[model samples]
Target: MGHTTSTSVSARGRSTVPLLLVALVWSTSAVMASAQAPTSLAPAGWDAGIKLSEARDRNPDPSIVEIDLTARLADVEVAPGKIVKAWTYDGGLPGPLIRAHVGDRVIVHFTNHLPQPTTIHWHGVRVPIEMDGVPDISQPEVKGGDIFTYDFIVRDAGLYWYHPHVMSAAQVGSGLYGALLVEDPADAVGVIDEITLVLSDIGFDSKGVLESADSGGPAGMVFGREGNYILVNGKVMPTLRARSGAPQRWRIVNAAKSRYFLLDLEGQPFYVIGADGGLQERPETTETLLITPGERADVIVTPRGSSGGTLTLRAQLYNRGYGSVEYRNVEDVLTIAFSDQPTLPVQTLPAVHRDIAAPKVAGATRVDVVLTLPPAGADGKSEFRVNGVPFWKAKPYMATVGETQLWTVKNESKFAHPFHLHGFFFLPLDEKLEPIHPMAWKDTLNVPIDGTIRFLVVFDERPGMWMFHCHILDHADGGLMGHVHLGPR
Candidate 1:
């Protein structure tokens, strides 16, 4: 086992703090065994007695793995002396970590116990039409005190997440998300240390209470709700110890409502090997990677030997055309300190998959998803719009199955919006509508604040209803969401 430590980190991104004081109510320890049993904080009604760390992630059963999650209210201490009332699964700030391997069956028995309705939408998974978890689109909302089952084969291996579909503005915005790591059975992670970080930000009022989803009034309405604190795996700027010469794989997920993390390493250079869909073809070594809301990045690095051996994962503060109002300095998300004593062996990686096929363009249809913002209303406030329509009243776009299409996503908003599409990954295109990477697949693409992004997508196999929207949960909740019907019809 290795040593673990934490400290009270300020939101101002100050790196120095008293070491004795740990973050929030959690203590310091290595990635240890599961708790002896469930705590009282577990949802009391159903069989919600499960530990946060014992959520079937390490199960090597090599078959169908089934689990239960009870969605209910719980209190999580985000920082020292700071508690936020949150909607959780099995009573935790970030819900259970769902783990599976490719070709395995994942059966999640979801039970909703909150006062209102909710549904667990697999954020990046291409599941069946009836199991996609979009209320009134793919499936109905799971009402309070109701139970629903999500059984799907782990087809693609990658980093993904799950959160609520109904009331996402409040449910996910407040805190109801978790990581879903689907490993590739043939190409496994190597001996090096691996960490899965669910990066998030939380907002609070002057009264030290958790801010409501609607707290951000007008400007926040147009732009997404921005939080103050940067959290990694539920802790504020926690410190992680890594061996001097070991490589590490950080599977990171940006689970915030609006915060865009322009991550950069202070000590070592990062090799971006995978994305929301899966591994990239060849590793792209870069100093910065932009991870927007609802996006995930699988980066590998060998920390130590640079910057005096003080490895830090910092975000280059990005306002995304929000002006100086939301401007803040760079945030230190996590610290990776070199250790004299070794822990785990360095992990090895297999051949990457970079040759994603391009959509056939000769006979492909051209679809326009032009994001448009309407004029300010009488109240001098503006609501988000997609194709000049909102989700509550928008008409569904129809596409044929087995058809290749060139999608033009023009972001006409004042602020940047990360667009995400369900059911399929698309290949990015250049200004000429030609393939950019020619081999990279992405389910989420960053549409610049007043710029446009093009993609070539092929609707293969599944004939289902899928939602495409701004991944910023608040923006999506504000009606920046739309749907598409894919069928032989």
Candidate 2:
């Protein structure tokens, strides 16, 4: 229970509405100007029926969440009659959900029971370097039977996650990952029926055996291996019971190794309110939400139709690169089964927004990073490069603490790459080097094939080595990774 004040939400030219208003409006219909529904929007078991198993908090302190996490091998059933020996955290696929409040201290006592050495990378979190979980850069790898402790403060209210930083492509694809949600008590998104969806995939043989990480070799590495099975919270086409026309807040995380989840709700619009770092300046609506690897989206969707009818959440084909969508078909991610109640009238949503200022870039230092894929060598192995060299042969980029830098990343390769920066959030820049509208902090952005992305970031007082790489685990493992040395001012 750290008493840190959060600036993620701001009341600018509008009233600061709290979540309690939702209950009040639904119960009495006093404060809202929209059509009222039954006090119980969802059935008794509907809200908690389709959710990931949560990690039990051991700490009694209201502000500190402590949990023990073990990485081991477990037999998880992704689909009926199909079970695979998957590498997992806490012996479960997609691991247990870790929930904490904004600015709360989280302590994870981790033990590695798996065969290989591994470390847990807190994705999209603003942790100190020592807790970053990148082997050899921030901390050493935790070998088999070894124990480690991760202690950090949740500075931002958003959906983050954790996974193995060592052998990420193999480990994460084998089911070694979980979700970390940091919530703000003052968040104005008044919807209470919220669910956190972890989107991922895994491949297995016909007899339910896990696929090899090196199954495709060089060609597989070039295109990034995708699982044959799509998963939402470790289940195949799991069904959720929802009330018709009742808004449900969805915090979605794309945890796939390389797959991009371009989600569509039968052409129905999704009200996107937040992203990787937290709530944006304002909400936007889109018929489809593209959540790339390692990305998260906070959105609201109202499932509507005849009672007892179901609506499917489908993952449409997205062209990440060549062959990504050549013969692929749409994937059914989740099935929302509506309750037997009649559809309620459409209600007007509250205008919930955040106040985030664009980073000043007038005197920011500029850095250029070119992503390229060279031809296979005599060994017939493909490798991705940054600035014309692989991470192994490249020098560390230098930056001083308290300095702001504008990075222009140009992808000259034939494939798309989800560029990710560790330990900091950046503001995506437009052509004028100015922050994009509906300003929101981001830790990862998708760089399309032969495309470019620019962003402005400042290295704060924390000085240590930080990593930057492609979120596509295969590409990163193939050498499209680098580090930055943030020297003390």
Candidate 3:
């Protein structure tokens, strides 16, 4: 963060790593100088394209890492030749990556300079009640030119993110999200080349203008906002260099309003090691991994092939609940090039993370939740409902602290929705009401159309009201969001 902003830009003809990517670098020297801010080793006023090594150094001591961020309106290039107006954090496409250790203390100094009120919700982190950032529930909205400090202990280690809670659909859609990595102490060096890919679907208007909208129609209301362009770290077709036969860790996040990413690498199988909460006991191999909105997947891949062999990262396109399908050479987010350098050894992992027991709903209370869509209006606008009613500003249910509850969610809607619950992770149940991943933890999951999902969660986190909503930002903004109060019985 020392006024040195660098980016790895790989053009069509340029195969070598370029030193200076002037276009990707946004100058914050003036802002720092104007504010007379003090310098620190933490990632304050940093860029999104920070190198892996520099990023790791910024959080050498997680116990005292101070991540400074600000929200403001700016115009930046989202695509190669596309310039769009956006509300951004530190004037970057996606905000700077905040890295720390599991036991570290994360202090976020958030400043809002936008036209409206806003707050940063530390997505998926089990922070304190006050640090949750939900307006009127945890804390009031930080008004324009105002500042708020969110300090909390980093509980779990994994891929997570941060974005505004108020007007989340508009704010997050305008490019205000970024990734968070809390490292596990057991991970050894020479393990793998770790990288982060913040996947987003940037929506542009008919006249090529960026706006916070879900198309204002029945389909959008039902399906949430889906973008035409798929971007990885704010670029299209970015070349990601990987050593041949070397194990590399790819931490991927889907920070879109609605689009679900069905990820697959050509000729390479994904060895998923972790999910939204953290690393699994061992790697789970799969050809196709469905990463819904607000979910994360930590994958280890080794491209074993000749030099210059291109491994493209493609997302299979589907008309959610419809009939149409598209595949093969779709939007390419990352092009994995097997470099000529010698490959390193595969990474080593611990026996297992601390014992995370299965969700025991044997005698736990059962709660039934249903998802449905109200009939379309005259203008073809539909209202997405959770239980025959759009979400009002109130807690629908009061959860008992430290108590286990079995919740069954049925999707009677026309399309699939990524179900996300804040504050705690749950073990999803199978058709027979059994623990699916009794050990592995996840905060966000997808609920298929005309289907059902049941999970048992032990609400052991701090007593407070937490959000449970569709990860599709538009759906949440369109009154498909609610709060669950977790307090002492």
Candidate 4:
């Protein structure tokens, strides 16, 4: 899904010891007289120079984080003098960052001020059924001027995200998503410099007007609509100041409605340490990181270049289906400008490891899900199907609390689907039906076209209706979606 080419770019030699980057030395006395933000620690605001406005914690207790969230239309300038009224949460594209530590409680007082009804789905978080935010299944959609409350506990530490569940594709593509970071102080990853990146895109016409969600009709929906403009934390081609050889931990989330991200940082290797559910058993290195829609990647990178020079971080062309990359060009996601300081000595990354046991699949219940896309109907409408039937005409797959199911997801269509399951994580299996190496938990995975994906998921004691669908929101809305009942049907 990505280009595989690696080359050395370090301007100096590398060492095995950790080299702490020194603080910036300012010479201007007038600027020094004013208050100076800490330059030693990520220079106050790090990656992309687009600092996400964080949600305010209204509560006084340290263990509980509460914030008021609102979904409405706000004018946002993605580029210089290029402004558009976008659907946003709390008047910002990419919404406010919600941060909390493991075992902390999160309370979100949500209000809907948009023209349509909406609900906030906490993607990848292990919230209870009542807090899952699925309309008609967990709760009804909050209409305009309506309010709702979302309260959940952060059970795992990872990079997760949130967006509207109703009209998901349209809402998300219109830019109504935000990042949620859960931290564990006990995490063995010794790297302290980390930044949460919310990767997404939005479609707008050349005249600075938002494009119609249903722009290309059924065929467009079939191929999945991708924004013409690529974005990083809601900014277009933002700049991140970096010191060559300084390592920075990045927790990245792919929040695009359908687009996939195949990131390449000047062909440098990325030390991947974790996925959807957090740290894996061990770290692995890869030249290009392919993050499908709704997936997350935890990686460590050491920028290497000449001082005062720059490198471009590009999103290589990824072929998700027909015409995906046929005419599309590589997009510049971010610019890494090396600071004036001399390159810090390249240091060996810490030995990061976790002990994640493989899930037992002995006699697990078997479920077959086939994703299909037939020809257009008489009305000239195309519909993607799961198990030969669209969601509206399908029955819910049944399971019980404490039941384990081995799902064989076969994609018979011509496009890839990022399969996602709500409220739980699963272990992907290999051809031998064994857990993949460096076992990590995942709730979303890309099922290649005309291929199959098998995963084992245990329906824990949380009983209710959960959703399973394509993370390509357009496909899901077109019918490639279904429900799983964890209780009596």
Candidate 5:
């Protein structure tokens, strides 16, 4: 369940006042748990199984393992006598948590049990080119009842995720998603009482049935046909028990296809210890956090004097897009019941690494990417073009061996585009004229509406054609996507 928007006014100057008031009200609402009712878990005896595929982790302890992706129909008593179709992994929403060391290898023997073709993309994990799981780009789609194996090395240790890269909007929105945790061996920084939260919004018809796919319709493109149900760890109104005064780490990933989450912890101070790639410069504390789809955050919350009480996790409503669809004061996202126990000792947080800097754009080649919409009467077409040519055009976006390049991405539309590059992470030269977070090493960055984002991107790792595109599923499907080739890098 979500929260309601606040109606308080700030006493500060007009501009800052609205933001402050919103934050205060949002935070207060977020910390207040719902007293209405708890949803029932899926009943036993529902069975669905898929082969566990294999992949590798590149960061901490390099080893190999397997993962399974399958779904089942279950009776979930969300309301009295109500059951819904839940696309899941191992038959459970939120699936099973896949944890590994930094350098371990993950092999996912994925079998498609759904009626359509699907493939899993390990979000944020850098792996072999063939194992990246973008259908047609890396490997063929796993058809219904067909099996495919994905093997890759986990290059970075952080809070990451796995979801369908094929027909992502339909598959992920149906709940074929889960969290992946890669821990650092040497310094077990965030090992205490960790919790994983996969945040997503579900859309259902008046009869509670999920809407079918639309082949490039405006309704599908803009609002993403957002779901009426918001789930955390597969449960509506879920709660985790934590000891009072304990320093708890929450690994939060926004798995929604389009919705952006502005999480407010009800004035309770917490530090953002990690981002999509990994740990940040130091913990930055705040009351509210904004995370778009495909983004991950590892935050630390240290309870104050209020132990043996409940802490609510709520979502604050803001404008849905560039226009006026106000969505303020939503309901709860999750809740935590604190027990009366001594607070655990606070461990020393890792320092942000400045040594591994992004290549400066001064000595790099320049690449211009123009995101274009399909022309009129193109048969319900939504396709992206680079340099005025669709992806099918002959010439590839190629770079010389070991060359650093400046990528200037121009968003021609009014929607925010979270651009993602495969095989490498780049630093945003400027995000809205402000420098990004100090320890920001990212494979995905959100480009604001009608704005340009310049990134000093380097291609020094491998030689292959890699994809770069808006992480928004509908936008990407509609041709707001491209790929780059690293020649003998």
Candidate 6:
């Protein structure tokens, strides 16, 4: 997580709005361009040996169970004999992968080894409010020298993750994050080797020391604090070993604080089997996939036999504001070394389920939400507001229990917002109508630029105040967040 320092809004006056809107449009266009860029090698040498896992079974074979998440500073070897200071979990940048099946109970005895207090928020997991791990909101921050047990039952299964919710901008960028795979037992397991790719960006000097967050102001508020180095599973460049002619399942998550990743596997064809919520209506095959922060993509790639061959995963250059920022591609994210070894029987991917009972919204209540930017100040300082209010602990947004409500999210801001709702998943109902994807059930959804996103959501579970905000870390930190309170049971 990174942030631009906040400044007094009165300083800029009204002149900042046009520039802000232009910046937002520029950022949106940049993402589109980057998504289409070709794959290339990265500047840094790629690192290998990161592990992958399967989420079919709730009980993880002890071989892969129990990941110790401790914060410690270590030297990361980016180039030959060049090591940089990196704050990591379990000794790696993008910590170890934790996999489990839905309904399985998981107990992670987490120890806060960092210099300051921190708490891990399970990004998309549905657990008790007490176990949510939000500092001062759900639970207390885990202090250094203290240990806390994160015990919860996985309810919905798909691609999810965990990161420090306290001082997230600093802690997350310091490399305190990892992947969490929750398996849906009822769904058919897909054929192909399963892999988890935690995508992140790091801004560090030649010595590997990360850059500090920007001082908040107009530039920081609209442009976002971005990094220079792109990483996949903590490696500047990584390669994968696969048998020739093997189908692989890739679970990709955009863990970047502010940058959205447009991933392209040069010439290799793949299908997007799932999204942030879960699987899509059907697998949409394409050469590239775009994922924003707090979003996930479950894709399947079949590597044709090419012995000792390489597959380059490149981040296309995206144009953001007045001009485009180039992602110097050099090192391949991962190379697939094919062997002549006989491949195992391929598993068929699961079919999209459409019969899951969803509550009807026509008979439920409705709520209107407005996502906007605050009035600019004379100092060119800009602020974000949601529903005419900033983030406040006591004044949470609320809705009735057992009610299927229509949430009309109007984006008055120029930039696109990926709004996330905690606890309950929702289905997008078009501009005014609901078209729930066959496999769609997600806690996060992206809103279009200068557009409105309407979703019909049913709040039937236990009532509590859950978080709702843009996935963009800077925007979220700058008071673009609020909580939705479900009526008491």
**Could you give the C-alpha RMSD of every candidate to the true structure, in order shown?**
12.1, 4.1, 11.7, 10.0, 12.6, 13.2
| Full candidate order by TM-score, most accurate first | 2, 4, 1, 3, 6, 5
Backbone clash total, candidate 5: 48
TM-score for each prediction? 0.83, 0.93, 0.83, 0.90, 0.78, 0.79
Specify the poorest-scoring 10-residue window by lDDT in model 5: 42-51
Model 6 per-residue lDDT tens digits across residues 309-364:
66677766544332225434433455665654654455343443323334566776
Q: lDDT tens digits, residues 1-489, model 4?
A: 111101111111111111111012221111212232322434335554766788999988877889999999998999898887899999998999998866678999999999999999999988889999899888999999999999988777788999999999999999999999986543425556777888898999767778889989998899999998888889998888777888788889999998999999989889998899877767899989999999999998888889889888899988889878897888899888888777777666756666555657797999989899999999999999999899999999999877779999999999999999999888899878898877778999999878899999978767899999999999999999999989942
- Model 1, 176-287: lDDT tens digits are 8888887642223342346688888877664556787787586676777767777777667776765655666778889887888998887457777778877665567787
What TM-score number comes out for model 3? 0.83
Candidate 6 achieves a global lDDT of 0.65
* Steric collisions counted per model: 7, 1, 0, 0, 48, 38
Runs in model 5 lying further than 4 Å from the true structure: 1-62, 71-82, 206-208, 305-308, 320-324, 340-355, 372-395, 431-435
Error of 3 at 337 (Å): 1.9
Give lDDT per model, in order.
0.71, 0.86, 0.70, 0.83, 0.63, 0.65
For model 6 the TM-score comes to 0.79
**1 or 3, greater by lDDT:** 1
- Candidate with best TM-score: 2
Clashing pairs in 2: 1-63
Model 5: per-residue lDDT, tens digit, 1-489? 011112211111111112235334422211212222223111121111111222333334334546655654443433344455767777766666787655556766677788778888888776656877788878899888898877776656677888888888888877788888875432235334556778877666656576665633764675444566777765666666666555566788888777777788787876786678666545687898877778888787765435567788887764435431454446798766665655556644333232234465567898877665545344654455556765566366888656888788887755677788876666677754333655555677777667788877667555667887666676666666677877774
lDDT of 2: 0.86
